[model samples]
Target chain A: MSGLRITTAAEGTTHRVVLTGELDHETAPELERTLARLPQAAGHRLVIDLSGLALCDSSGLTTFIVARERALAAGTGFELTAPPPPVSRMLRVTGLDRVLLARHPQDA
Target chain B: MSVAGHQVEEPEDREASFSALLEDSMEDLYDNAPCGYLSTLLDGEIAKVNATLLTWLGYRREDLVGRRSFADLLSVGGKLYHETHYAPMLRMHGEARELALDLVTADGHRLPVLVTATVKKNQDGDPLLVRITVFDARERRAYERELLRARREAERERERLQRLTSTLQRTLLPAELPEVLGLEIAAHYHAASSDQVGGDFYDVFPLDADRWGFFLGDVCGKGPQAAVLTSLTRYTLRAAAVHDTDPVAVLSTLNSVLRQRHDPGAPRFCTVVFGLLQPDGDDFAVSLASGGHPPPLVIRADGEVDVLTTPGGQLVGALPDAHFVATSARLTPGDVLVLYTDGLTEARRADGLMLGEDEERLPALAAGFAGTGARAVVDSLAEVLTAWADEPSDDTAILALGPRPPEAR
Candidate 1:
């Protein structure tokens, strides 16, 4: 079985989600649902930590984009942290790296 | 009196001993059954467990009998799932059958197992205890993992193949349409399917300082085979146009090359319209030749639409000496000349009517587009195509060329 683990930690107004696993079409929905359930209040910061993520596919990228859009609509800050090399390369190839990548919470 | 007493005593002692032996074996059978068995309190605390289960889990009776709940032995994900879904379902249904779970043994190893559990109730129907039976599922789990890996590998291979097809399709067409002096030009290519490369192609390039060559064509089929023919036809047309600017000569050259490469078992052919444009004052002198392709539509500067007739044409590369027809027209300022593949004409609407089958519909449609710039004409046609109920049934390539007004030039 493909292993996926999601752990959410809340620090004041910032919500950080750490992900570890292969994120393909099968598991992308799990991440989507997790993000969708997060509190969407103005000025709330949502950070996805990808330091432990081993793999990601196009569907996973789409989920991240959707989360970013939702955050923007809700007037919240959103960003991705420490995406693995493969995931970063995919974003670059699709020309979304600069638009979607946020190095720090303040940057977002 | 002594002999009767001895026989009676022996028979009574044997019957008592046989009854005690049967009672001892019944308890042993429950502990040594092939499958693991356990009984948990209503709250999932282990109340009693058999020897078979204790051995499989590598746990001593004292370590688990009243110490740990069943949920504690599961993996983190399994625990979460059990709490959120399994436990609630079991409570509502009173039984959960053949649930697959990963158990963490005392040695920290994972053991996949299939578990069946039922709630045992007292005579008053109040739930009293839960009984569970577990079967080792190592072999089944391994088989399932293999199947999943195979499916994932197949999907990856398919994605790679699609990327390759798209890259090859891009190489078959010009990177950008050539800009001719004093003329406005635009082009669009609509692919009927993304899974395979389409056979439609178009190009506009300078033939000389004073003239330009353009062509739009469709191969007989789709996919890799037709893709090969498309590339070959495009290269041959470009090379022939360089050698001779005559529209008919350019097509005849492609015809001979295709005929030479044709296989008898799987004959290949295409329909093409080759044209040459030369600047003439504030207009362009256009010479076009057709090989079993649709005629070009000229939307005049005064909002009059006319189909340039190039009759007596035959399908290219089908025969050694196929005939082609050449026609000439002058595209004045504000007059757009549109060249397209049969995909446009053959497109079927939701009601099953072909766009090209009704000649009146096409001319009437072009009438609305008369006096529009080349870019507008191409863009509007693309929009019209997108409005179809389904993707165009075939690859469609459209190229429009028109002269610029004197002030713009």
Candidate 2:
């Protein structure tokens, strides 16, 4: 029932986690646990595809930061692709997108 | 010799008694006056001060009569404030006028007080000594502090309430829009002012792989009552969609839910637009249901923006089984559909101009953003509103969903 999903792109080590649903106090911890499990990609990248995100709150923003930090410490690069515009703008203002790789266009 | 002696003695005795009475009255008046009484020498030395001020400060006269100057009884900051602010004013004025100050107590506490000093003059009209009066301001200071504390507490509570309301408000909307293949979703909610709560809401969710359910509504009021109705409307829409894909039936059920429980006498009302978004292999088909709400704005893949012309939707809960209007449209990749609350259209500028309703002005942003895609369109849409609503908006909310461009695939 958790809105978070983790799957490695089949051919590459690029771990792509697609986040769906609302991230609030109730569900943000679920993401923290999920992000902690992925393989340590020393040189590879982690892309969080947020195309499915409907609403983002403080808990959601914090979870992304935690995910980005974990990726950073692991020597893995963190990227967030396809953030819904509202979430994307919030990240921009909070300067989170600068830490995580953020591509505004959600499609590709 | 005896007569002269007796007469002289009587006058002397009379003079002595009268002088004694005069001295006693002076002491009594100085010690018990409503205001504090003190005299300082030219060098700022306390020569004599009354018992009234001593009592106000919980001090003994012996402690200050000759041992301490007036400045010794001031707090560190109060001392500095007096030196820099009060002293100059007092000196320049010859009588330091009513100056609010704090005098330290013997017990190491503070006394809020006001003091006024006047320079006494001799017969020659030369400055002789300074006499000061101290009035206890404990009651006034206490009252002012209490008022400040209450204001600060209320502000903190409002901020907490805004957060709580925002948290609850966010829950009322979809957490994440269901990712329909080849679709980009954009949403914005413009909080009016955090001072008070609002009833504006919007949402989009997945109904099926090829279809999605979305709506935007404005509840008529505020506070706990409106919040409860908002929750009911949101959950009912989500659950009712599962039971019926038809927008009208879903609204009908919502009307019944509102009618059954909520008091119509309280006059609760809401404007809502429910839509089922279906995508064909290459094109998208949308069916919309309206219940006394604003029409949805559609930006076509071809860069044309226009209001979807669905009208005559009845207010939900106003009447039992109120009729709702339904409409449809075809969507190609790059089509943007935006549903919003009246707050967006009704946003007023300081100049008193309002951003026209979606049906009128949405196309300006949509047309300009034709090639840029849904995210860009929504960004512009939100930006236009921000610029237009420089003043606080009542309760603006928007839900935008569009098909992804070929590159997004």
Candidate 3:
């Protein structure tokens, strides 16, 4: 129940990575490894849906920021969508929303 | 039941031989039973003891019978247990089974044994004598001792690890924050586990005669590797501040250092808030930059709390061109500026709800101690974090800076 599950679904050029369950010190590495393997080409768009994310701690947030960094370096479009209230607050408090949520098409 | 095929010729001879065999077997079984058997009178005097009991204790049967009581064969602790627990339980329950005790041997050595005693009563239910059985427990006692020794060794190793972890953790932090003439400074750090070092670190040091620099940050992972990163991050920040005191430039320098030094396979990154303090005539002028770190909160003297939110800042050391934004705040008298790592906000309440889940929780807490100086604010908040329902899951680091109140100055 406390474990994190990561699933990826691709529709055309947009790839959606859905994260579910708690994301803390123990589960952040799994997300990191999964994100590393995903295609971050210039034309590909990466969207991380946090609706199912029950919890996101420091390590989890760090992993997301690194994922964003990787996407940027590769010139791929990156944005986070559907952040749960708790995760949203975390990003807002840390002022990460400015960078990670800049292109939130749905939440915008 | 007689055997049909057996000879009926020697009935008298068979009866004689069977009687002799039964008598011989009965005596031999009693004298050399695997377990020792003894009977003691109501006064605890040994009336009879089997040959096995005498052989185990290296004594003759007559040596223990009638001359020495059963209590006389017990060690000091065994004698106490016999008189207190063993004797009383047998008297009330009529039997005591499998009581472990040490018995003294004839040669002044201790023999561990399991003793089971039953009171043999008369037909009228009157207590007559006690029949006791003894079994050797040498191997069992030795096994128990070995287990105890191994447990103690494990405990010692854990203690040694904790001590080493804490000592290394201390090196990553400043022993004391430099005392700015007009500003009061305080900081606190709480590690989640003592055995493994946490990744949180903070330091406050003087930059110039009238200026000071401070930073608090948390690395992604923990343990020995994290400690090494923490040490590197702390020194790099200090050295960078020396070259450029601007909050943005200082952090930008750190970002480059971390990205270049850390291995590609194991990328290391951290969330950091770096600030510079300078005296501005009765108040301290503070300019801080955030690299995806939680914004600092301000508590006014009037009991109002404000979050100094700086947007558009990315995590330091994670990317090649990470951006950091600087925000300015003036710490007037009775106004405190507090900076903290995510460990504080990520702390969960007893109900599994994180303290940061409610954005107003920390502001509300800070409002309670409005106008308090840096020391009091840091100490109070530290107390709250320490006594939280479950200790903060991660390492938490907090640093508070405030201008001295007029009355105290």
Q: What is the C-alpha lDDT of each candidate?
A: 0.82, 0.74, 0.86
Q: Highest TM-score: give the candidate number.
A: 3
Which has the higher lDDT value, candidate number 1 or candidate number 2?
A: 1
Query: How well does candidate 1 match the true structure in TM-score terms?
Result: 0.70
**Residue A68 lDDT (model 3):** 77
TM-score each candidate. Answer: 0.70, 0.69, 0.81
lDDT of 1 by residue, A54-88 (tens): 76754576577668777877998998888877666
Q: Candidate 1: deviation at residue B304, Å?
A: 1.6
Query: Model 3: how far is B233 from its true place, Å?
Result: 1.3
TM-score of chain B of 1: 0.87
Residue-level lDDT tens digits of model 2 in B1-409: 2775574457878898888777467778889888888888766678898888888888888888877877888889878987897768766777787777889898989998888888888998778878888999999899989999999999999889888877877777667766667778888777775654568777788886566888889776666767787888989988999999999998888888887864422545577888898877766788988886767777877778767754446767655546777888877787888787767665667764556523346557657777566677767878888888776547778777777767768
Clashes of each: 1, 9, 0
Candidates 2 and 3 compared: the better one by DockQ is 3
lDDT of 2: 0.74
- Cα lDDT tens digits for candidate 3, A1-108: 599999999988888999899998789989999999998888889988889989887678778777877787788888888888988877765566767774646766
Error of 2 at A24 (Å): 34
Per-residue lDDT of model 1, residues B1-409, tens digit only? 2685664457778889888776467668789888788899989999988998889999999999899999988999889988987798789999999989998999999999988999999999999999999888999999999999999999999899889988988998899887787899999988887779998898888888899888898876678988989989999999999998888898899989998965643456777889999998888999989876777899998889888766656657755676778999998999999988767766778875567545677678777887779999998888777675377767788899989888888
What's the true lDDT of residue B185 in model 1? 92
Off by over 4 Å in 1: A1-108, B1-35, B50-52
